[model samples]
Structure formats: C-alpha cells, structure tokens
Target: MSADGGPVARHSPARAAVRENDTVRSSLEPAGAPEPIGSMLARNAARFGEKAAVRHRSGEGWSELTWARLALDAARLARFMEDAGLRAGERAAVISRNRAEMIVTELAVMGLGAVYVPIFAGYGTEEIGRLLEHAAPRVLFAGGPEELEKVPLDRRPEVVVDYSGRASGGAVPFAEALARAAFSDPGDAEVRRFLERAAAVDPFEPCLMMYTSGTTGRQKGVLLTHDNMLSQQRALSMLWDVSENDRFLSYLPWHHSFGGIFEKTTALYNGALLTLDDSLGKDFDRLLENWKEVKPTVYFSVPKVYQQLYDHVVTHPEQEREVFHEELRFVFTAAAPLPESISRFFADRKIPVLEGWGLTETSPCCTITDMAESRSIPGVVGYPIPGVAIRIAEDGEILVRGPNVMRGYFRDEEATRKALPGDGWFHTGDLGEFYGKALKLVSRKDRVFKLLNAEKVVPTLLENKLAGMNPYIRHVIVVGSGQDFLAALIFPNYYLIRERFGDDIERAEREVRESLRKTIEAFNAEHPVKYERIRAFAVVSRELTVDDEELTPSLKVRVKNVLDRNEPVIDAIYDPSSDCDCRFLRKVFRLVPDSRKCFLGKDKTLDQCHTCGRVVFAEGAPGVGEGSVG
Candidate 1:
C-alpha cells in the first residue's frame, strides 16, 4: 500500500474517476493486471508478435526487429546470462547509445528477474566508473569501443560484451554471445517455464537501478520496481495517445529515466516501433538524415536539442521544411523548461512541441501537455496523467502520489526518507501551480535564494524570462547570494552576433553588449527592484555543451559548474570599484549571433530591437513580453 492509505493495485479507480473534461483516458482494455514488468513485456510480445518492434538504421539501410524477433533475442540473451552464472537478483549494466541491442539487453535482464542498469553513453570514464562501483554490475555491456574504454580495468566484469565491436581486447562481441547461445538453444519449454516463473514475480521486485544525473553531487542509484516503470509508461501512453502504430524517434540518452521509461519502454510496451539514432553529437547531420528516412510520428527530446533543431530549421527554412510539417505529428520536451519562443516556433509551423515535467524519482513522467486539448499552453506542462494524483502543497511544493514513484534510492535510507515524506505524497522539491487543469513549474525549492534585502528570487523564472527576451541570448544564468542585486552570466549566439555585425567581430561584440545593456536597463526601469533587476553580466563566447560539463546529458545548464568555472568573470561583474570593467560587466557581449538568425537573411530583422538586443514584435512570437520591445 502507498503511504497515502490508497490501495496499491494494478489500476486505481481514484485516478480513473478524476474529472476527464480535457483528459484522454487509456484505451487499453483494463485487465486483472499481470505481475508487473516481465509480464507486461510478455503480454505485448504475445499480442503483437508480428508487429515491427524496433527499427535501427545502419549503413545498409533500415533493419527491422519484429516483436517476435525481439522476444527471441531477449530469451536467448537471458539464457546466456543465466548460463554465465547470473543470479535472479544480480545486476547487469548496459552502457550504450540508443540501439536495438540495448533494448534487447534491458528486456533480457528484466525477463530473468535480474536488475538492469543503463549507463549514459555520454558519460566520461570517471563518471561511468563511479556508477559501476555503486551498482556493482556482474556483467557489463558496452555499445562500442568508446563506451567499453570507460569501464575501469580493475573493476572489469566477469563477462564483457561489446555490441558495436568498436571495442577490442578480451570483451566478447555481441554476435558471438548470440551464436554461442544458439548452439545450446534454451528450447521453448525451458524458455516458457523461465518466463512463467519470471511472471510470477511480484510487482515490487526491482527491475532497474537507474542512477540520477548527478547534477548536484555524486549520483545515487535509484531502484525502480516493475510496477514503477509500467505505471509511468501506461500513464504517459494514455496521456499522449500513444498506440501500437505510433513510431517514436528516440535520441535522448538511454540511461535517463525520461529516455529509458517514457521514450523507450512506453513505445515497446504498446508494440510501437522505436527508431534508434546513435548519431547524437558525432554527427547531428546523420540524425537529420535518419529523421528524413524514418519520418517518425512522435519524437521525444530535451529542450536544448529542440532549441538547436529550431535554430537549424530557422537557419535552413528552405531545406525539407514541408516534410516537418506533414510527417511530424507531435514533439515532447523535457529535462528543462521549454522557452515559450521555442514552443511557439514549432506551434506556428504546425508542430506541437509539448512541454512536460517530472523528476528522476518519479520515473520521470508525472505531467504532460495534452495533444487533445483545444490549445497548447506555451509554458504550462498540462495536466497529470491518468492514475497519477498531483497537488500543490500549502508551501507551494508540488506533491505527487503515483505508482510510478521509485521504491527509493538504492541502499540510501537517509536519502529515501528525505525524498519521500511520511505523508502519502512524495515531495517534488519543485514549486508549481495548477491552473485550469494545467501545471506550470515555477522553480526548485532548493534553487530559491535570498538577496541582501531578504527578497526571495527564483533564478529559473528570471532566466527563462530573460532568455525569451531575445533569440540572440542562447543561455542565461542569474547569480546572486547575500548580495544587493542579481547578476547574470550570458552566452550569446556568436553566429547571430557575427551576422548582425557583418564580418567585424569587435563591432559585433560592441553591438551585442550595447543591446544587452539597453535591454537590462529597460528591464530594471520596469521592475524597480534590486533583486529582480540584473545589475551586471558577462557575455560568454563559448557554447554550453554536455562534453564540457557545462550541461548535463539532458542538456540542462549545470548552474554550480558554470558558476564555479567562471568565478573570476562573475566576480569582476559584481565588483563596483572598476568602471570600465563594470561597463563590460553591465553589458559583456560576445561575437556569436543567435543561431535562429543564421538561416534568415540579414534583411529581415523582424523581432530584433533597434536600440536594445531584446526581440521585438515578430509576427508570431509567443508568451508574455510583447507590445514595446523590452
């Protein structure tokens, strides 16, 4: 039973009975509910055996894996793992990109009642080593040589399988593992008996050990039961109208909950086809190439990726513009707040970029924007999914009660107690509001800081507002603690600035700085408050990226890291003794132009402010901050 005294069943009537005025209920026929994870996979495999389960693009072309094929691969892998001395509750870790083999590994691990741990492919060797130490996986599967190299030599698993063959040395190739297992063929009888035994397992059995993104500190492994994963998948599927026919274009890191559960498992459980894209950073062009060929109906990605894609589209509007309008049905954004400008950009082009909200602890899908709703709210994350209950506590923290919530952080009782309250609902550290059946995330409770005057400010809200002010400002972070006023660290779009200033980089910097200064001055004039007004700022020339550790794998800004790395720059901004330095501080401008302006000709500066750097009245710019330029 949940702490809220609610019955912990396969389905909750309370969730079903919630007002469905703008809600879309699950079309999946209610059943007696098989024992969680493995059963769910088995049921889908049985019902949709011949359906295209997963599709992966290779040099040759698209390689399709039917549900039956996936089941067979998973069964074979399971038998191999069991034969290799894997215990029922032992752990198997997969460090890979989005690939068919990764999915097969997950299914196999879960099918045998063994815990599956997925390490992000983007993680450095040190980060991967830490997670490996924490999870202590008996067997580790690496996607390629790069991922395999990340595995510590001292802690090397008893069994190491490389799916991509890019890795050399003692690791066994994935093909050899399958070929070896084929000779022994666990047989239909043994496979069925193993599956049945696996199905008999309880819902509370831990199926995965997902590690947090480690944004704050050392990452802790989060243990999620089969019920937790399924509940989230079922809830999100119902909310998003996902069906067996729906095709999902997956690019997000497979290790994160959003990608692992919402994007991957949700599609698999519904018998939908998952198109894998391994070309994340090495070749973004290849990702678009895959998209052109796959033409996925549904896509899930982080805000940064969407921002980049929007930039790409805006810059190259003539290239395949019609295809995006006709083929792309819906796009979902998570891991960070979706800027209204980005959302409106897609909405104007007939692409519904829905902003959703969740955390690592909640299996990552608690609320999502509804596609069936009359209008998509730009900033709001829509309503809670079916079977999920959400409420705003008196103190403004968002409280959620659902089966999707994790059992707890693995072996971290103190952290678990700190996260899950004595009350039935889990305290989401985030502050949010429920308006007209929509949920709007405000800021993290821990993120709120006080100024010298004791005025409380939410940096996230202010940053979002500032970033929306102009397309040129790529990323903004407000910084101040026990200080009289707030300051900002701004990363300007070099391409946009250069385009604006022609070939002269110095002129571009000056123009960008002056524009930023005027915008901040105007904002200060309007706000008339120390905490709200950004007094000083430093324009960063470089872009924040996952590789640089300035951003997480999900592409969220690493606030502490950013601040730590640029401490001297931030210090110079706050120092009032120096005037010229302060002038640079007040308006530190970079040479980069907004990526959005790269494609659009310099002749049409539609939303650009003449005097300020802020975006003015562009034809269809969304959200507040219209009328006079900021």
Candidate 2:
C-alpha cells in the first residue's frame, strides 16, 4: 500500500506470462512518504551550505547563490508573503521568464503552505486574464509592469510583487522585500516563524495547482501535494545516480509540469547547480554561448531544440567538443518523439538520448528510457519508474497508478472522476502497447478520426510517415475528419531550401513545390486503401507560432486551433468548384473526379485540363497560370 493509504499494484517480471488484464509496475517497492518542501530545502542547505544552489547571468559574468543563501531568501520571501495576508491553502501565481527568482518564489509559496501557480510567459492578455480569474490568487508575482497589463484589472490579485526591483503600479518590488527581510541576526522572529510554518506543512495537502496547456480544451487545474512531487524524485533516484557535483543549464519554462515539477525539482532535490538559461530555447546562438560557459552534466529539452543543436554542431565541428564535453552525461527529451537522425547524432558522440512519456496530470513522468541503454528505440518510452503502475485498457488507452499522480483537478470533480475512476488507475487518454517491458506510444485516442464512410484514420501514423519520407517537410498535420479522404498541411524546412536552391526566391519556391507534389503523388500510389490515401495537400506559407495560439509552449500543435485558423484553406481543398489564388495553396487536388483532374504531369503545367478544358493551372507556376498565389 502507498503512504497515502492507496493500494499499490505490482507487475510480473517475465513478459511471456502476461495476461490481458495485467498491471505493469516496477520491481522495486514504493519509497516511504517524503518530508515537506521546506524540510527538504533545510536539509539540503545544511549539507551544501556554501555550494552554489543556483546561478544566473549578471552583466558580463554569472552570479552564484549558495544553498544557505537560497534558504535564507526563501524564508524572507515567505515572511513577506505572510505579512501580505497570504495564508495556507491560498494560491499565489507567478508570471516570469526563467530566473533564479522563480526558484525562490516556488520555495516561498510552498514553504508558507500556499499553492504555487506558474503562468506560461507566452500566454496572451486574454489567456492570462482567464487563468488569473480561475486561480484567484491572493498575490501575483510578475517579471515586470509589462506582465501586469496582461492581467485584467478586475481579476488582478490584491497584492502584486514585481521582480524588476522597482515599484510599479503600487506593486511591491522583489528587491525591496528581500532587502527588508535581510537580517544580520540568525534568529530573527519573522524568519523563525516562517521556518516553523514550513516545517508544519502537510505532506498530503495541495502545494501546487499547475494548469494543463489547454490544447484539447480549456486548461484544467491539476492539484498536486508535496508528496506527489517528492515521490517522483525518490522513484528517479532508484533508476539513476545524481549528486551535487552535477550542473544543469535550464531554460524550460516553469509553468508546465515537464519543467516545473520534473526538470526543475530534479536539480534542486539532488542539490545540483541549476543555471538560469536566459535564451528560453529561442536564441540558439546565445544558447551555444552559455553551453560553452557551463558544460551541463545532464541536459533536458524537446526534440526541435536538439535538432537545431545537432545541425549547429555538425556544421561547426570545433564547437561539438564544447557541447558534448566530457562531464556531459545523458540527454533527456520529452513532449514529442525525438527523430532517429538526431538521436543517432548524440549516440555517435557517446551521449545517450533518454526519452520519456507522461502528462501534466501525472506529475509529467510515467516512463523513461533506461539509463543503462545508450541507443533509444524509435517510439518506445521505457519501463515505469519505481512506485508506478501501468495498465493497458481494452480500448488501447494507457492507464497509470502511482504515488506521483495528482490528487485531482481543482474545482472540477467531473474531470477528476472521469480521470480517476476509483479503480486506482488514472486514464491517460494516450494509446499505447507494450514493447517487451517498455511502452510504445501509438497515438492520442482522440487523434483517430473517422471518414464520411466511417473508416478510421490515425493522424499521427500518417503524419509521421509523411514527415519521415522527405527531408524538407518540417511538420505535417493530417486532416480529413468527416471528409471523404485524408489531406495534409505541410510546413517546409526553409533553411534547407535556401541552402539548396540559392538566391532566386521564386525559383526556389517553384522547385520545392514541384518536388513535394511528386512526393505526395508517390505516397498516395503506395497506400492502396481508399480511406488511407491522401488526396489533397497544401504547404503552409509560414510555421505556426505560440503568439498565434497555433502551438503550445512546449511546441505541440494545437489541433483545434490549427483547424479553425485554416478553415478557408481547408474549404478550398474540399470544395470541388473552388479555384484558390491564395499564397502557398498550391495543391495536389486529386479528391475530385479524374475528368476534372489535370492531365499534364506535375513537371509540365498547362492553362487547362486536357480532358475537360476547364481552366486549371498552378498558382505560382510562371506563365502557366493566369494569377500567382504569392
């Protein structure tokens, strides 16, 4: 049984004896319940007093804050929050880019027994307002006055703490609060009171209320206790070895669980040095510069960032040594599947590429590729960590039960009941299968949609196939729900296009479009199933962005947002009589009847179809069409 009085299920070691209703779990027993967040910090502070707990860029060089100093600052911040009327069980929200203060803020909030809510920096004003209203925090901590504008006036918290070190809009400056709390006396009354409160925090009470990315629907608040976060660390400690000698350069935002609970706490819990990466995964040039300065022992990031890093290292061979330095251990990637090519690049350099699969609802880590393994299998996220149990539902959905799972969704009992049905397993909504002792992700249950004829199509399978078939296809989203056949929206690799096709912009676009057309035609011919074949496609003009709400912060495509935004393009693709002149809408329009199809091959364009003589021409094809798309 778990420390929370929940039943703990175990699985078999041998795969051959497995049954349909078997529950898979780690061989090791679950660890005992952990101390509260404050107790862990105090312990770490005593052990590594002078050692740098956190590091951040200060002007031309880096500034270090020792573990002892971090503890002191946290106590100070907690005292300040207490003075502002923030109490136990109340919420305190923070909106900021990654900095040392983020770590301080979390410790302070959790120490005071108040819930910590980190808002994604990429969220817009309306999204920010919505979240603020829902959380209804007693105090809000922001990066600066600019973030203040995002919060609606009526929804704004009563107390605001600005990190800019200067007063703005009647908000308390973070620097002033810390400076006021700084005391030469080791036994200050406020600090003692704060420490006492921290030690008294309940292990099973909710300390975090992180919201989901809201890709599928409105974001749900996932309530997790101190034990949920600490239990994950205990599970990881069994599979891997970590210590204070390690260094981490972190940029993953703290708003999401992948970074907030998993990555960030992984470093702090192990007493590792976490450098605040200012780049935030945006500016690669700056990232490489920081990489040279602090050679991280273990790295965590998404596949896209690794791809970019791989490209850079391949081109600049000298910098390869700096990135994959001797002290560097394994690289951990999650949120999306890592392309085999990029994984191979790291493997070639003797760096193991570790991938994981989970959701925010599970404290963000259910399975991680084995630390003993060097090469990763394409889609397999390995065996469950210690204390976790995995079961495959009849419908192929992945189900999990573990000490690390969240308590429930805040203020949404319906969602909580649907997710945790009193069977001890939390419905993951992901489709998967067992690959030996490991788990291979199939697709999201909702991603498999039906056609007008009722045949099902797994969009992820087709998307992966289309993306893998070409070097220039950066992203592919398969679309055709309730339609006759499948179609795709392709985003191109413009960097490769520029390198191969050179300075002539129009010629480059035309040549790439023709190449893609042939690829799609060949793909259609290869797939014999009528429902599986892709009959129409369009290469989007630009890549999707977080600002446009087409992508989540972790870079997952927001499917509904993508579909809604491209309704016009989709209409043109499905409409038989529509002749579109929009930019980048050049299509492989095979969905219509053959009599209306162009007889001329992709290479040779004409003004009209050979059979019907109906006006048919490529939008951007020079002299072949009446109008140009771009």
Report the C-alpha lDDT of model 2 over 1-630, residue by residue, as the tens digit. 221232222232222122344566776644556768887787787789889989999999999988877878888888788888999999999988878888888999999899999998678888899889889999999998778878788988778999986646788889877776657343456555666678679988999999998778899999999988888887777666667777888988889888888888999998988998888887777988898888888889987678777767766678788888877777899988777778778888877778888999888888877645666676788878777888998999999988889999989999999999999899988998888778888899988899999998888877766766666787788999898777788888765565566799888877887777677877878888867888767777787787898878888889889888776567656654544445435444443333343322221335553423445445443322221243
Compared with the true structure, what per-residue lDDT tens digits does model 1 show for residues 144-197? 898887778976788998997767878888877776664333236655665576
Model 2 is weakest, by summed lDDT over 10 consecutive residues, at 8-17
Clash count, candidate 1: 12
List candidate 1 segments past 4 Å from native: 1-34, 166-169, 182-194, 372-379, 494-511, 525-530, 576-630
RMSD of candidate 2 to the truth, in angstroms, is 5.6
Per-candidate Cα lDDT values, in order, are 0.70, 0.77
| Model 1, C-alpha of 218: deviation from truth (Å) | 1.8
TM-score of each: 0.83, 0.89
lDDT, candidate 2, residue 601?
A: 23
